[model samples]
Target: MKVLVTGAAGFIGFYVSKVLLEKGHEVVGLDNVNDYYTADLKYDRLNELGISKKEAEIFKRKSVSSKYSSFAFIRMDLEDRTHLPSLFENESFDAVCNLAAQAGVRYSLENPEAYVDSNMVGFLNILECCRNHKIKHLVYASSSSVYGLNEKIPFSAEDNVDHPISLYAATKKSNELMAHTYSHLFQLPTTGLRFFTVYGPWGRPDMAMFLFTDAIVNNRPIKVFNYGNMERDFTYIDDITEGVVRVIEKPINDRLNEKEYYKLYNIGNNNSVKLSDFINEIENNLEKKAEKQMLPIQPGDVERTWADVNGLIRDYGYSPDTPIKEGVKNFIDWYRSYYKI
Candidate 1:
């Protein structure tokens, strides 16, 4: 199958693109490569997929991978309706994994417009392109953050996500809504995978795991939000890619008849681990104690997030079960090797 993976340079998207290529699928990658964190890390991820940094830095110029004949990448934003339409017409992608978005939750408080442009406007363009191009499947990333302040134990797709605490969560919920509109009216097969706290090797620098490890290694104090009372269903990168692939390949769920082809599932570890325990794992792997600075939870932050992944397991015959210890060790090893620490 031919697949177009948006946000191909991102942590999760990078792994997903590689796995698709390994499975003998033709892949076209796309990302604006904005410096939300740092464009250097984004380029490095592309480098791993056999695309040169020189080749990917240029905007709108599609470059075929130096290593993988089945893979190619383009530096472009999703909100570019003019070019996005043409790209869809030219590629005629069989499926699209729309992982591109403005990303950070707390950052949304700083720049709410970024979330609207990338998550809302950009997503609308994806729907229009998929609808016009008649793409078979549109598998996109959603977030567990949509659950917001709900007291729900294991966040389920069926749970009400109408009240989001942050702009980022609101945008993700809006994506699911927008996808549902397309799926219902156009019969497009759309699936929204609400990802939990995904962490592993090649992870994003802005994410908690990376921040904690980096601060610990540098002997800087690590912030313990909610005073270390938080919990997260931290999933590994490989598990996320596997689940994404399954959703991209599998047929529409039973909920979809001729009426609506929309599906939503929580992609998570199905188990929550306390923040203190997670930090402890990092400390164990690095063999260095962290100078913890306990602080109140920041705004737009939830104390805990646990995804109810029964729907995913029932539909995909898969579950994310990588032990926290193993995942942390893999990440620590990569961090050390990548940084020469």
Candidate 2:
């Protein structure tokens, strides 16, 4: 299978591409290499995949590694509406995993336009390209934040997600709606995965796990939002990559006689962990006490997030097996090795 993976330089994208290559699938990686957090980290991820910075900067196609001859990388952005169309027309991708978007919920509050451009407009472009190119399947990254303030214990794909608290969540919800439209109108098979608090090694720097780990290792104070009352279904990256591969392997097929081919699922750890407990695990792994600064929750921040992955398990056998302690230990190990902490 020839797979087009957007945001290939990102944490999840890098992991996903690596797994796909391991499965002997041809993967074409696309990313703008934006400096949202740190482009160096992005490049380092690409470097792990055997793409050099010099070659990546030259705007020419590059191979993944010496062994993975089927893998390639391209320097492209989703917002490049003109060139993006050409890419699909040329590559004729068998399927697309759309993970490129303005990621941070808090960052959305600061830069609303970025969200509009990447999450909304850019996603629209992907839908258009998928529809026009007649791609077999399209799997996109949605968010658990879409279930804003729903008071639901474990968020389900069937839950009402119309009322989103943050602009980022609203955009993710809007993406589901747009995807349904394309699926209904053009018979495009689409699946949206509403990811929970995804955390692990090579994770985003803006996320809590990375931030807290950096702060603790550097003796900086870690801010406990919502007075440490928050709870999250912190998911490991390996589990997420597994779920994604399963979905990619089994494309939804509701077109023959069914009314709709669009579907959504929550990809997350079924168990929710308290914020303080997560911090404790990190502290325990690092063998360092964290200097805590309790503060009110910032805007666009949710009090809690949990995922009901029953549907995922039933459909794709997606079960998160990594415990929080083990996940934290892996992340701490990576942090220590990456930063020599």
Candidate 3:
């Protein structure tokens, strides 16, 4: 199958593209390569996928990966409706994994319009493209943050996610709603994966794991949010890639009803780890104790997040089993190697 992976420069998307290429699928990677965090890291991710920083720097031009002949990449944004449709028509993608978006919950508080443009309008373009071109499957990334203020221990797809604490979560929830509409109206097979706190090697720098590790390595104080009372279902990157690939392979193909065409699953470790325990594991890996700055929870932040991944387990016959200790060690090894710390 030929797959178009949006946000191919992203952490999850890069891993997913690598796996897909290894499985003998043709891949066309796409990303705007925005400096939301840093374009350098994004380019480095692309570099790992065999896309040269030089090739990826040229906007809207397709570059074939030297490392993997089956892989190709184009630097572009999702909301570029004119060019996006052209790419869809030209590539004739078998499936699309939409990981591209204005990520970071806290950043949304600062720039809410970015979320609306990328998550909402950009997603609409994807839905339209899939519906118009008759794509087989669409597996898009959702988030555990959508369960904001729900008080639900293990966030389930069946539970209500109407109250998203951050604009980022709201956009993700809105994507699910838009997907449902597309599936209902056009019978487009769409699968939404509500990802838990995804952290592993080559992870996002803005996330807790990276921030804490960076701070500790630099001998700076790490902020212990909510006074060390937070918990997260930190799913490793490889596990997430596995689940996403399975969903991509087995899209909601049955045409029983509109609901049948649209599916949602929580891809997570299914085990919540306390914030302090997580920090301790990182400290263990780095062999350095972090200076802690105790602070209250920031706005647009949840106290805890636990994903109920029974649906993922039942359908995909897989679960995220990587222990926190193992995941942290792997990340630290990669972090130290990448940064030469």
Angstrom error of the Cα, residue 25, model 2: value is: 0.6
> Quick one: how many clashes does candidate 3 have?
0
Most lDDT-accurate candidate: 1
Candidate order by TM-score, highest to lowest? 1, 3, 2
Indicate the worst ten consecutive residues by lDDT in candidate 3.
250-259
Q: lDDT (0-100) at residue 147 of candidate 2?
A: 96
Clashing pairs in 1: none
Instruction: Flag regions of model 3 displaced more than 4 Å.
Output: 254-259
Q: Pairing residues by index, what is the TM-score of model 1?
A: 0.98
Ordered by lDDT, highest first, the candidates read: 1, 3, 2
Candidate 2 lDDT tens digits, 203-273: 99999999999999889999999999999999999999999988987857632246568889999999889
Candidate 2: clashing pairs of residues? none
Question: What RMSD does each model have against the real structure?
Answer: 1.1, 1.5, 1.3
Candidate 2 residues lying further than 4 Å off, grouped into runs, are 59-67, 254-258
lDDT of 2: 0.89
Give the per-residue lDDT of model 3 (tens digit) for 92-188: 9989999999999999999999999999999999999999999989999999989999997888899999999999999999999999999889888
